[model samples]
Target: MWKVVVVALAGLVLAGVGGVALAYPSLAATTCPGCYGLTELSPGVHVEDGLSPAQRERVGEVADQAARRVTAFYGGRRSSPGLLVCLTEACYRRIGGGQERGVAVLNRSVMLSPRGLDPVIASHEMSHVELHARLASSAEVPQWFDEGLAVVVSGDPRYLAPESAPDRCLVAPSGPLPVTLEEWLRTASADPATYARSACQVSRWLGENGGRAGLLGLVTRLNAGEPFSALVRTR
Candidate 1:
């Protein structure tokens, strides 16, 4: 089965949406070929999918939380709903979606194939959406911050069985070693289980020292072109 995975930025493949490479401008709602069904959640925010009621509700909750989180981070909320979740690959295909596992347009919704939509996975992917939006533009986010925070927001902070988490969240090859920021940026994608653990490890470190705010600060600084060596020591 086809599952989305993160590709290098140079390729324009969405990080989580199934891996079909496309130019960033092509991801807009009107332009997107795969427009699934749409359901308004809050005032402007709506989720687009063909999921059952229960599943739809799950999408709404995550989208709501993502909106709130982004507003808190960037000091403003989306006037128009900036969230989208697709359940079936058909929905993704309608938008001319790529093979990348998922894609988040900073300041907009996220698009992913419906083949794997667990509660944790949904939250995790939406966090990427929130991060993307809060940054106001995609260029502001780094892969480490984008992926790590996705792992943190996916659910209550705790580990689960391998079968329970998304496959891509699993640990990467270098996971046995003490992972550093450098390693996080350099490493390729992993299964959900490994991704979750890696996020946890980074989240744990952030919490032990600086909490989410601290982590955000560190990320922001790095994104501004500060060296990891400097931010890592300060954080």
Candidate 2:
């Protein structure tokens, strides 16, 4: 009877672990890309099984273009993170994606859903990967700065005016901009204009500062142990 009880307890523990893994499949993708049946199409690029050869080729092209764009914006080259493309919604959900067209998994990888296959979206996600890779820890970076910088780097027209100065507010925010990641996520979920607000603020800062040079200088300062608040104080 004791042996049976012990086995039952072990099964329960395993089941709990399995449940969590199922709910958050990104855990497996981040640590073990092979676990989800992804096929490597090229260096740092992986795709789910259902993508055709043509789709695979498209993914590679998009990834390359995104990398080039981000590199150009930074004025320096950084290694590209792993790119995981999911052609089907099932695959996207299996890899823990929801409404987001794409998501950057830490600084290691970016997962692209079917709708996220566009160059702009890919570049946007890659922007996150690039910034995160530059820092020892992203905890020091404000959520608005991170997200807004990604928008600027990607030139996402949805949030900014076309061919206009970065400081121009394309979409007005419904409320105050968020600072912390938690607050950013909450506001983003509730208000679609959060990205616009963030982009506007960062753009305004860039305009007042030295634009691209200023951004590079800020990153250099952050990397050299300067506090973000001190580097990015209100003028």
Candidate 3:
């Protein structure tokens, strides 16, 4: 009877592991990138199997450009995170991608779906990585500011006017901007234009402050143990 009970417990543990792997395959991929048959197209860029030489070249070029843009905006450089690119829907889903084109996995890596191959999308995700590297914890900043800063840095024309002032509101939000990640996700799903609204508000705030300098200052203060609320009182 004791032997049977031990076997049952082992089976339960295996089942739980399988469940988690299915729910979040990205965790497995990050843990062992080569397990998914990903090949390094460059120093830090990994591509799913079956990607052609031209496709690999494109990914490398786009990632390089994105990194440069982010570095320029931040006025400093952070270590490049692993970039995982999936060229097919199956690969994307296998690596835990959903409706989103791209996602930043903390400050460690960025995963890109087939549709997220553009420079703007890559830069947007990398912006998240940059901010995460700077902060002791991502929780230090609000969700709106996080996404908004990405939009601004990526120069996402969808949310902001080209060559226009960043403070100008383009698309009105459906409601109040979300402060937390959960609320931001819910509001974003309900109204896709929440990104524009966030960008608008952050842009306005940056304008009132010192622009990129203000952002760096704010981050410095946050790192030095200053409250985000007191630093970003304009918001």
Candidate 4:
């Protein structure tokens, strides 16, 4: 079993990630020969050939819907045209050369598992894109918070189980909230509760102040070079 690796960045966030860049190989370059073809079902969505036209349309619909949903909640600063999404196991694995369920690149390119193009996954990946669009390349975002927000917004049920309060280290009174956002996320693993904890913390903060607007404000502050942990410091 592959442990998920997530990274939250200012302009390019990735789940099950290694790093940045949208340099996927062409569809014809997949390691699995003759296993993939590309189709443009919508202005900005490219799907692999295994899906029928109807399935491709549905995938595009899901992608568009997810983009709208995430941008609406996180703000519309996302200016990218759209994205490239893979829909086959061979294509997903071959494009990014990874076994992680999903991958999002800086150029708005996404490699999704065959069974992973549903609304939840669609929304989750788009969340990264929208948030990334709003972020600066140097912003400080915790991995847990990044993944949590995506999961909650996507309505992904697995991590929906409410997480108790965040760790004391995250919320307890401290001398200037420790700046561990980068290191924590860089090393985070596939702990289901970690996502829930992030969701809980961010959701709680938003709930306490403003909802979507609050989230947008946080993005703005982050873009301005303020660490998210500092801005949301409980004490």
The number of the candidate with the highest TM-score is 3
Query: Which candidate ranks first by lDDT, i.e. highest?
Result: 3
lDDT of 2 by residue, 48-113 (tens): 976777988899898888888898888875657888888899988888888899988866789999
lDDT against true structure, model 2:
0.82
Higher TM-score: candidate 1 or 3? 3
The CA root-mean-square deviation of candidate 1, after full C-alpha superposition on the true structure, stands at 11.4
TM-score of each predicted structure versus truth: 0.55, 0.84, 0.87, 0.69
**lDDT by residue for model 4 over 11-111, one digit each (tens)?**
24342122322354532232222334555666666677667778777787777777776767665646553555666667666565366566566525555
Which segments of model 4 are wrong by more than 4 Å?
1-36, 75-77, 161-190
Error of 1 at 90 (Å): 1.8
Clashing pairs in 3: none
lDDT of each: 0.51, 0.82, 0.85, 0.60
Give model 3's TM-score versus the native structure. 0.87
Per-residue lDDT tens digits of candidate 1, residues 1-235? 1233333453454443434333342254523433335555555444564557897777667556655654554355333424455666666666545665555544345555564344455455556655544443323433554566566555434432232454333343243422454655345343334455555555555556566677567657656777655555312
Worst 10 residues of 3 by lDDT: 166-175
lDDT of 4: 0.60
